[model samples]
Target: MAARSSHLSLALLLVMAVGCAAQDYDFFYLVLQWPGSYCDTRQSCCYPKSGKPAADFGIHGLWPNRDDGSYPQNCNPDAAFDPSKVSDLLSELRANWPTLACPTNDGLRFWGHEWEKHGTCAANAFNEHGYFQTALRLRDQLNVLDALTSGGVSPDGGYYTLGQIKDAIKRGTGFEPYVECNRDESGNTQLYQLYFCVDTAGDRFIDCPVLPRGRACSNRIEFPAF
Candidate 1:
């Protein structure tokens, strides 16, 4: 009896060790949107059914625009993400934050799905937090709109009080624009860039590959919501 108990304890310890190590090497990238117009439910896992706040953009998976020079097809949400086997890394990566919160009981179905398919949400929580760093850059565009009613703010400092923030995106001040990642001509991972410039007249325009928001701002600020 004593020997059996000792063996059981050893097995339990080994299992615990394995679980911890699994989480350590697990590097995940949240995809804000999948290719085309569909959200890959198999890869979205950050938020549950509680309904994400207006400001939260779960995770946008990797965008492959530069890879084939053409947008990729939508992902099949039922695809699996392997937690074990390092060799399956890429496959799992294709579904990092897998979810089952959609109204459809079949597969990839959830609230964030719609926003992500359109490249509206953040690629991950980290990306969302980064946007807040330079709140001022977006404040001019994000402020006036009633996030719940108005889609968002207008570019000319005009307020919209009855639409979705996605719609309000048209009102952006163009300081910190969205970014697009793809491979370069040299076949290397490259980040396309876009910057904000305050002209002599104090005007800004949306430019090239936008950088991750709040990353360039030297000052840090907190965004409560919207």
Candidate 2:
């Protein structure tokens, strides 16, 4: 009986060790892109064959990030992106995650890149379908445009303080989001993206340990008109 008990304890230890060694990210960065800002810099933005996306911020990507400002990508080579797996989500994806690359691009290519680079890394927590479904659900839950507009921030070429933007998002979502911006042709800082950190479960929001590299924004930023 003592030998059997020892074997069971060893087995449990092995299981725990394997769990700890798993390829898991620290958190998820739910990134949203401002179409207006992107088009202003690029001079032109292409839409998928479906149609132009709504003026609202679109999903840039759902990335897996680490605590040290670095992130994992293309984690599983074998888990290649399969478009058929997410066929049911194409409508929502086209509406929310449209490709804005220049010279026109397909949603499938954008999804493939996202899946190969980021989705594969998050495979332990979510399969391809769950990874995308969670993003769409979260986008519906967190309304960045409404949050800013309600807080007196509009896209009519108005300059806002970074503190104001963060405060507004916190008031709307009960959590502060990491704000990112880029400079316009006139050298004014404009809101480019917003990233909210999510736990590995891809369910709840969490405070980011460190922001993404080179995502610093000035104290006052502009929200360009679409």
Candidate 3:
């Protein structure tokens, strides 16, 4: 009887260790891919914006509105453009929860800018990596929300707090947390950060792209649920 009890204790210990190992693996993977997981850039100054002549905008960057300004000269066939990919972000929210009623407004609201609209919105508003990053954060957070509703573990590996979803963007996981955004040093819009969260009291939206500097719009994101 004594030996059986000892064996049972050892088995429980082994099971706990395995669980810990799995959690560590998931947490670290998120840390390493933190940046690439959630950000993208656009070609704003690369093409001259209207009113500003092509020469004034220069050739190094894109400026949104020039007829003959700098663009991907000799566009490659392999990298065709498409916008349907990101349009669903809005649609999904509408479909999943009908009463939310967040409008597909006239112009895009890119935070900080306070209601900037795209004259002609493109197919890929969320950018390349934004797809995976938003998906992962949303999925993980949804899991947490579900567990909370059902009364289970938070799935932060028991490390992050309930509010850490927003905090994690700047400080990351497995480290002493600290606030990192809220400035305009690198052309990153601080408002875009809101969209990246997995869950929020408000409607969810993905972080839009800021050309030249990726993740600059991290603060501008909306946490829409669909």
Candidate 4:
């Protein structure tokens, strides 16, 4: 009986260890969202406690996904998000990944959700600070507004085809991107999120292996203003 109990304990420990370790994923989808369209919906939006984010695009998340468009979520629940780990990045995160969810917050909950839901899965490549660090670095280097405006695609409530938008971003980033859209209060289509694939290292951009489904937009979509 004593020997059997010891073996059971050892097996349990090994299972726990396996479950707590970092995850492996094929690639990452570095998603960026436009704040203007987010709030323009019927659900509306509240600014972050830190204040209204910049008119520029903000991060949605650096989601870990497989080539088949499936993804891992809430991986390694033991590795919860710790604000202290990213204390140095709070200011920058508030500006780049601020929450527009209702009942305003200091962005911790938003960051926490992202960290737990998606960031944890990238543990093999990033710690808490490194996760946000990579995202902020990617966002800072690629200004979606500049990418669009530079190609005569201003967000002055103008309507543009999906092709036009994709071409502009491709020109700016030197790679193709997948544009997602949402409906405004007036029932018109507007830009929502932009998806770009990145290497597991979270460094440079790469062509997406599989474009996410259900991101269809009409022949003409609005690039609403902030």
Q: What are the RMSD figures for all models against the true structure?
A: 17.4, 2.7, 20.2, 4.1
TM-score of 2: 0.89
Name the 10 consecutive residues with the lowest summed lDDT in model 4: 17-26
Clashes of 1: 28
CA lDDT, every model vs. true structure: 0.30, 0.86, 0.26, 0.88
Per-residue error at 110 for model 3, in Å? Answer: 5.2
Q: In candidate 3, what are the lDDT values of residues 48-132, reduced to their tens digit?
A: 1112121110011111211232212212233333334445454332222112112323222221011111111111223322432
lDDT of 3 at 31: 13
lDDT of 1 by residue, 1-226 (tens): 9999999999999999766533231121112321211222223224334333233222333232211223322233332222232232323222332333445332234313432331222222223223222222333333322331243232221222222232343454312334233332333222222223221111233332323332221111111122
Which of 2 and 3 is the better model by lDDT? 2
lDDT of 4 by residue, 1-226 (tens): 9999999999999988766453357789989999999999999999988888988899999998887779898987899889999999988999899899999889888899999999888888878899999999988877777889988888889999998898898888787778899999999999999988898789888888898874689879999999
Q: Given candidate 2, what's the lDDT at residue 12? A: 100
Error of 1 at 8 (Å): 56
Candidate 1 residues lying further than 4 Å off, grouped into runs, are 1-55, 67-69, 72-80, 83-101, 104-175, 178-226
lDDT of 3: 0.26
Error of 3 at 186 (Å): 38
Evaluate candidate 4 by giving its C-alpha RMSD to the native, one decimal.
4.1
- The TM-score values for the models, in the order shown, are 0.23, 0.89, 0.20, 0.89
